[model samples]
Target: MATAVVGGRLESELVRDGSDRTKGLSRRTVLGTIAWSSLLSACTSPMTSSGETPAANALATPAAGQTLGSGSVRIALIIPASANGNAGAIATGLRNAADLALREFKGADLQILIKDDRGTPEGARAAAGEAIQEGARLILGPLFAPSVSAAAGVARPAGVPIIAFSTDTSVAERGVYLLSFLPQSDVERIVSFAGMRGRHAIAALLPANGYGTVVEAALQKYASASNSRVITIQRYQLDRVSMQVQAEAILPVLQRKEADTLLLPDAGDAAPFLAQYLASKNIRQGDIQILGSGQWDDPRILAEPALRGAWYPGPDRAAYSAFAARYQAAFGAPPVRTASLGYDAVSLAAGLAARYGQQAFTAQTIANPNGFLGVDGAFRFLPDGINQRGLAVYEVGTGTATQIDPAPRTFSRTM
Candidate 1:
């Protein structure tokens, strides 16, 4: 027998159990880690090494009022449950992760009102409005970029803080925090690491989309700061023809050895095919170091022979491994890339409510200079809603990735 806390009521139903806890997380990092050791006792996100799975019937996507937990404080969990394809699948994983978090943190003192965003701005707006009207003090999701923006419109003026899951930095703002793995942070980590290895003069083949735009800006900003120059950049739309055409455009520069590092800031086959294409043109891997954004965290992509020795950034694998094992046991499927955001957000909220009570979601608490160490790694929200994390660097090898640079354990007071 299992009980679910859906809003003000705790229904005796079925759910999942627990798993081992992880000390670190994935998502972001800067050069400096926070040194706020003294703050760990009071406001830091709490962790436990051991957890057991809860046994109960789980819903793939709750239509509404997935009301979880019977705690006094109210919080909202918004996701795109009605969206087509991947968005809906990710929504289920996020909800399960949030439920798993509440189970692990037995002391959590909040009721979660889960709302479906229908994967649209209007849907998210309605969900956010309903949740706030239900007395939600904080909002946890609405995964897509548009949905995050829509929810923020409602949450911001209501004094409700949101820890959204979108990676698009454009939607991030004063009260809307993004907890997804951002492309900009990945660019900074990979480029700076490459600079340390003396592989500067950067060149890139990026997508002609919003994600690509953010990556190019990050590359330019970091390249300028580090005295490195991006000798060339080419953008392509989605489709093999466009990708092939763009990669060919950059072949001349690669053949001339004008760039010491080639940044393939895309995920999936784009990075692999481009690397293979460049190799076929006789641009030896040793001559031009291949760099990738966190999007390269995919195992199959990392293990590609064409991408072997390429470097990228990611959250700690061990923590994700631990978390994934538990999630797999409970949900019976591997988590979506950004699923950890749901777990971390719920865990952090629980800790704040338990410790600081009503003052938990305040800017100061959420933006603790030291940042909170969670399932993905050490991450802290900024007033601008751009989350900073301590990200680890990895190199692709034979069917696996090796950590070349460990993530920072703490944060400095700088940000």
Candidate 2:
């Protein structure tokens, strides 16, 4: 069941002087008295997080001599320390969202603490401890699976819950909850859509990496469950030479009528190269529909003429125009995948906190079945803490992304 909290009431008191005012007090005396009165008033007034009046559900004011200023609530944001990686971008996005949330709840007196894990397990553990020592009640991230594992050891015992950004479901346990966009879900959606379109036989050109391996496994599992056939699966190193060799090797398979669908698990950066190779083989877009992961949202993919009609699953950008505009105004660039995810994560946490108070940081709260609505769309947490997203499918056309598939709905058993 979801947890709930009650908001505290504000009280006002007036102070009076015992002395008679038959003769008006001197200017100096009046000034001194006013200064002291103002100070006393400030001391008695309740403190707030965002500097606004408290909401109906705001936490009660702490007793006298307790932690000053509405009892500090710290949130640790553990992310890669590097400033140039995807993880880094996600971290920045989370921070930005948190800042916005804090601004909205100024009266709550919420304190958001941040820590960098440098994308290492050891660093994550150290950062988690530091946040605890600094009195953090909740943790926001450790963007990698290994980092989540390392931080979980420290956070679980303290009863501090974590909203991690790791994609690996295995890392979720105890008080840790994942807030990532799992590639498996994206693949499943793509495959199911392809199957519905009567494109059964499948082939893949994936990188020889952990992500690639996961995609391969997911494809096999979905194909079996969906009663589809996998005609060929090709692996390629990310380097130029290996990509060329792998493309050439797959050309023969592409010639087969059975291999009517091709899945590329790589991101947008690799699209142009793959498109060039596919064009050389005279494989037009409509002849064999190309399926891709959400990573294809990168603008670079649109530059490739051969990528037209290429389909991939991703969040609906049209629904978040305000967020996109504000983000661009602040960061001087449009929102990318990382930025959108980050905004959603922060908004989710803020909503949870507003609802649950102390219970907001609990594992059960993070994994609440109802889940949280985000800027991207509605998403729910599985038992393992990975977010089950309902993503939208888009097609590349004329150097732009166009929505082709209908918006996803909550998966009901009856459906």
Candidate 3:
């Protein structure tokens, strides 16, 4: 039998002595003796129950002969499989962050486990079950909204906390905490900043998807809250022809209404085409200031001349330069944007483990008011498990992103 007191809790289990199961004292008695010995030592010793051994007190080492438990704290990194190219790259970056965190917090006995959700709800549920079976106390992903929702359902009952990478606020509930950079916060920050810069009239080109819808709503809300007006709202499919048509239609509205700012939320894959279409319309980049979400971090936007002077809100890239350098050195490539998300997630988990131990590594602790800070930014988890983050504004100038506002400030959300 083996006994240990971990995080101020007594745990005992019977074990065979080598190949001789019947030899020596009874396993239960041995375990009981070990527990009693530990408790007696605690009474006589000045050590804290949280495992903080005083540097000067050398006699308080090893809990006076009680052996440490062999159980490992499992952490799952759930992401879409290798099929989706962009998602795969993001997952690789997340894995790299996990590897880095393991090296940083080596004393926690943390064991990272990877689970591919395959970008499906069913796959997420199965992956979550596998993680639980392998004894995972914390989960770090399921990049997509549907998968995050499904994985949260499976982990909640088991008291495991999930640090999801999905930007959708709806998926953040129960035991799930969003660790991704959300577009709504970015929209609010950019709109408020632009408003402060005297850009009153705003127009938007959004995709016909849930994410785009959220961005559109956020733009409208923020515009009204900031005392700015949204002159035109145009929706477009991902197709080039559809985007061209929408861009042309919006160009006439912008010209007529004289809107100075054009907000575009869908900036991936469609950014270059949208930029080209806007350029063809003779709508110079300087004429109308382009406001974008964090999605504008893609390098493709930098290549477009029409995207110059575009402003967006995102994580502080400068703060993560060292992390990116180390990640690239180890993984042979720089981490994707979501890699910072993973690093933050692991840091959050390690902080919780250090502060509250294994028992405190639950859903409620993640939703604490004084939440953990990471490479991305300062975030506090709400009661609903959604992380509220402050976003910094970045401006694209001469094919480079310039930090206009290095610090994130509070904005009115009344509208």
Q: What stretches of model 3 exceed 4 Å from their correct place?
A: 1-73, 80-89, 116-120, 272-282, 362-364, 409-415
lDDT of 1 by residue, 1-415 (tens): 1121111011111012111122233432111123532222222222222444433333346567779888999999998776665566667878877877776665678799999988778999999999999999999987767778778888888999998877667778888888876777778778888888898799998888666777889899988767789999999887788988998999889888899999987766778888887788887567789998765766567678988888888777777767766666666666765567787788788877876787978988777766777766777777888887777888889877889898877665211
**Cα RMSDs of all predictions?**
8.2, 17.4, 15.8
State the lDDT at 211 in candidate 3. 64
| lDDT by residue for model 2 (250-271), tens | 8888877668889985764565
Which candidate's lDDT is highest? 1
**lDDT (10s digit) by residue, model 3, range 274-379:** 8778877787678888888776766677666788888887766645665665455555565554566676676566555655666757556677654444555556
Candidate models: Cα lDDT each:
0.73, 0.61, 0.63
Q: After superposition, how far is residue 392 of candidate 1 from its true place, in Å?
A: 1.3
Better of 2 and 3 by TM-score: 2
Position 333, candidate 2: lDDT: 47
C-alpha RMSD in Å of predicted model 1 compared with the true structure? 8.2
For TM-score, candidate 1 versus 3, the one ahead is: 1
Worst 10 residues of 2 by lDDT: 6-15
Badly placed stretches (over 4 Å) of model 2 are 1-73, 80-90, 105-109, 168-170, 328-337, 413-415
Show model 1 residue runs off by greater than 4 Å. 1-53, 56-60, 413-415
TM-score of 2: 0.74
Question: What TM value does model 3 have?
Answer: 0.73
